[model samples]
Target: MEIDIKKHLTFPVFLICFLLIISLIFIFPALKMIVLGAILAYLIKPIAFKIQSKLKYSSVSIIIAMITVIIPLIVLVGYISYELYSVVSTIITSGSILDINQFISQCINYLHINVNPNELSQSVTSSFETIISYVMNYSVSIVSKFANLSLDLFILVCSVFYFVRDGDKCLKFIKSFIPDDSINFFDKTIEDIKNVLRSIFYGHFLTAIIIGIFGCIGYSILGYPFGAFLGVLTGILQLIPIFGPWPIYWTLFFIDVISGNYPRAVVVLLFGFFLSGVDMYIRPALSSHYADIHPLILLVGFLAGPLVYGIVGFIAGPLILGITYTVLDSYRKEYLMGDE
Candidate 1:
């Protein structure tokens, strides 16, 4: 007897079952790492493409791109991590924020300001002390868990290499699923995604570099010993929402003051002021704020992402929000705007 399998297994049924299986098998455990890999892949693929044209081997091209892109970043991150840990450890061991407190006292005393710099209640200091304890505890945990994190990072790197080399395959596979009527809509959505990624990777990162460059030049001119690393640290910290370059420079300013380097302290304060203004102008020029996703949205994402998703959340949270906002916005304009 001949069987008509098409009647028993429709396209939608097959698609649903296939997608469910795919999601169940891999999506849950590795989804976070994959997302990070996708971001790196998006940024590095163009360079890989350029190399691929000349090298005639995807593998060789991918290695060139990976080394070019990932190594320098690793170096920079390692420097920042080392410096921050060193500084924080020094402060905790020798343990005096008094230079800063003294400077603040002088400012309030001379400027006749209402700001009470010395008003940090014993209670407040103890609260901060408690927070520092938690951080120390977490650092120990981070050391213990390094193996797991390394494995995840390795998986992420492998994902990035394949993505840079064969990311087009993923795009093609996705495109295959789009219905004919939805082609135009799908293309527009893809453009929206491109725009959002541009804002995050190019706009945000370039702005950070600009701030970093300024820090480097300013600190070098003022004769700080670790100026380049300080600037880099400033730039990396710029990635966070509320924390800016002020904390680094201001601390340095206080250190200079305590060391009786009045000239350099003044210079540090000046650079701090100048770079603050530079950020206002330069960031807007670098990246487009897609769909005007509110700063509040970003602030929430920056704060909450880490709480929920560990370190990766800090980058992912704001980006995912922007993309989601654009998608919903487009749908509203197309389907809901007119109806209401």
Candidate 2:
């Protein structure tokens, strides 16, 4: 006798299978853009709300928020990119690096390495040529990358708008599928995730800006022509975790000391070392009273995120890790501790 297939496929089972299929169809392909949209939504949410208070229109508020935030951000990025291009171009074009090469030779000799200066110079020249060629190729590919990035940005914007506007509905839809008793656990896990992401992203960004301000002052005082640019660059570097401000400031210090500017070198030394050390204190200072966010998650997210997930991996990586951590911790509390 032929069994009834429709009878076996109950409503709940069919719904589950349908949802699973839907996720498979849409989730992975759009995951990166979705993650980016979440970040933008979180960041601009306050602005969106504040504007909505006056306008009372969610769509208009989102539009205003995007303009307010994204416009300035684009301008700032453009400025920083131009400054970086100028600096790199100047360094590559300038032929007055005899002193720098000599300093390298001295350092090599200090290590007691049996290396020829001419060969070292030639190796350096070859490396520079390779870098130049790579840069040229990268420049050629940038247009296509920009187009792709732009499309991603548009999707992100639309996603952010929906997330901010219909977030409650979305959450309700998710929770509707959860068992009533487990809803509390699900919400707790989500709360933990938000706290972690917010703490890491906001704290790191604020810390970087603070360091950038200090760096700008120090660079300006040092009579550096690109003080503002370097200051901004230092801030961007602060997002890198451990080796943030030291490399730039120390290099500046070295150049000064080598040029007989001992006092200037000492000042840069003090500033760089101090600014570099601030990350340790700043991270904890910015974490929420209830949330003790560690730097390791953000660092790992930053370093390994891009490697695994491409550019969007930066946000997705940490988010995935953070959520995993929360889930495991909750499981331990609920299931493992139940034995006790």
Candidate 3:
């Protein structure tokens, strides 16, 4: 009886089975966090590397860089939280329902629309009471969320440190198994990934910082309450493409109008328009220079991110698009252009 090993197992079949088992093993417990950490590490690796070059140790450099990034973020969040609490307390204590109602009535009058102030004031007061109640109820939930977020952030920071330190070793170990002929292709793919991450970071972050700074300055100049907080809020809103900062400015404008601060409001409104326009131009230019991806692709990714990944999705969205573009470009260059 001639026993044929080929009948029991083929090389390609065995390899596929092994890969499937390995993939399942690795992708189950911490896949999402791993993916998030990897993306974050990729974006920050350049900074880590720069620090490492100076300090001569990846681990130490990463720790320092992580602290540098984390501390400022913590301070920012703390400041914002404090400001939010102050605003909430002021709103609750002042009982400014009447002022708001009077402002609304004046607006209606200016627009030549007749309305009943007594009825409107009563309705407004009711609504304000409901809002306060809702806020009180929501406070616990928000606190719980922050607790969970803090835990997640701890994990994320630890993961990023390890990733920055061992990422290259991990890549090389994995790539070693690939056929020698395909090594160049794998290397190019990794390069594309790095480029995409850098592009996404450069594009979104720098623009957000600029907008936030300008917004804070503008609000302070106009003597808006909680100007810094609102400015930061404006920056966060700027992540949304096309119409991010408009609502913040518009609300402030309306508030000023009701307070009989028309000149200040008008000036703010104009400044807002200028800032918004500058963002429209600056964001795309910065993104294009870094990623070289299509504007429409970035725009779509910006819209799609929050829908897909919640808040983190916004960053992930453009990143995915950038990676896709880079990979396709690489493939075209290698397969199609070379053939031509």
Candidate 4:
């Protein structure tokens, strides 16, 4: 029996797609949180399974796993927030103009610059105050949206729990929709996606952690105030492709030069170079074992993701691009070049 060309399938397919679009529209607001939850769940699954082996209750195991994983993250964020607030508050209220003037005077003596120290100091102080004030106001606005943030968090938690527990089922459900002939392609694509995930997670994130730890140690040893914060900033910069740790180190070096601590400045600059060199070796060594994703793909993802999805884009953007690349590559290999 020949199936009707447009009688049975077209309307149903159209209706399904229409409904899907509607569903997506409804969920769009919380989409990023949900996506983040799924990504986090992927990371948490192995831990949850190990816990489940002992507890024998999936829900209990997942909750325990989440707590262990999430608590440290929450603490870190809280610490960063507190430190930022304290720093900003101090800089704003401490009448930094005198300090700026002194620094500018030192610059004049050291570099033989003929510029007006007072005027430059006033300009710099004004710019810092304006930026700090804007940041404080933004923070206040975020706090004002606490209720919406709480709802999003609630949804994220639920998503992670469900994804961790029922992830296999979800995979199976998705697999069932694939045609038999395309199953191999689907499977290969999925494996490649996994490799991409491992590449990004281990290669980028772990590298950041190692760099951050070294930064904390090196900066503290170098006697920089807020060494821990600088280290954290260094680690975060390590995640960006071109930025790396140079900004922090260069700023420190300049500060030292202005303050007539040339030796310490040189030492910090060298230490910064070491951190950058270590990244060159460490990132490739960790990521290459899983997948050798192109730097451009990741770079674009990192740069453009935040614009589209806010902060979560940092995670999702690279991932989506990497997965898309893998899928296309898989298709080419499995179908286009299969005979050859």
The RMSD of every model to the true structure, in order and in angstroms, is 5.2, 3.5, 4.1, 2.2
The residue-by-residue lDDT of candidate 4 on 175-225, one tens digit each, is 998999989888898799889889999999999999999999999999998
Q: What is the TM-score of each candidate against the true structure?
A: 0.79, 0.87, 0.83, 0.93
User: What tens digits encode model 1's per-residue C-alpha lDDT throughout 1-340?
Assistant: 1367767688899999999998878766777888889888888889988999998998989889989987888888788788877777777787557654666566566657886575743445678789989989998998999998898888898999988877888888998989987777777788787787787766667888888988988888888867888888788778776887888899898777766788888988988988888877766665555445666776787788888778888778877887788888888887689588
Candidate 3 structure lDDT: 0.80
Clashing pairs in 1: none
Misplaced by over 4 Å in model 2 are: 1-12, 15-19, 92-94, 97-114, 145-147, 288-290
Residue 192, model 4: lDDT of 91
Worst 10 residues of 3 by lDDT: 26-35
lDDT for each residue of candidate 2 in 116-188, tens digit (9 for 90 to 100): 8778977887897899899889878877589777877778888888887877788889889899878878988
Among these predictions, the greatest TM-score belongs to: 4
At residue 298, candidate 2 shows an lDDT of: 63
Ranking of models by TM-score: 4, 2, 3, 1
Kindly provide the TM-score of model 1 when superposed on the true structure, using C-alpha atoms.
0.79
Each model's C-alpha lDDT?
0.80, 0.79, 0.80, 0.90
Ranking by lDDT: 4, 3, 1, 2
Stretches off by above 4 angstroms in model 4 are 1-11, 89-95
Per-residue lDDT of candidate 3, residues 1-340 (tens digit): 2367667588888999999999989754444456678787776788888898899987888888877777888998899889988987897799766567778788777767677877877887789789979988887777878966676667677778788888889988999889987788789988878766766666777778899999999998889888889899988888776657898899888878877888998998998898888887887777767567776787788888779766667777877887888888988999889999
Cα distance off (Å), candidate 3, residue 140: 3.9
Model 4 reaches what TM-score against the true structure? 0.93
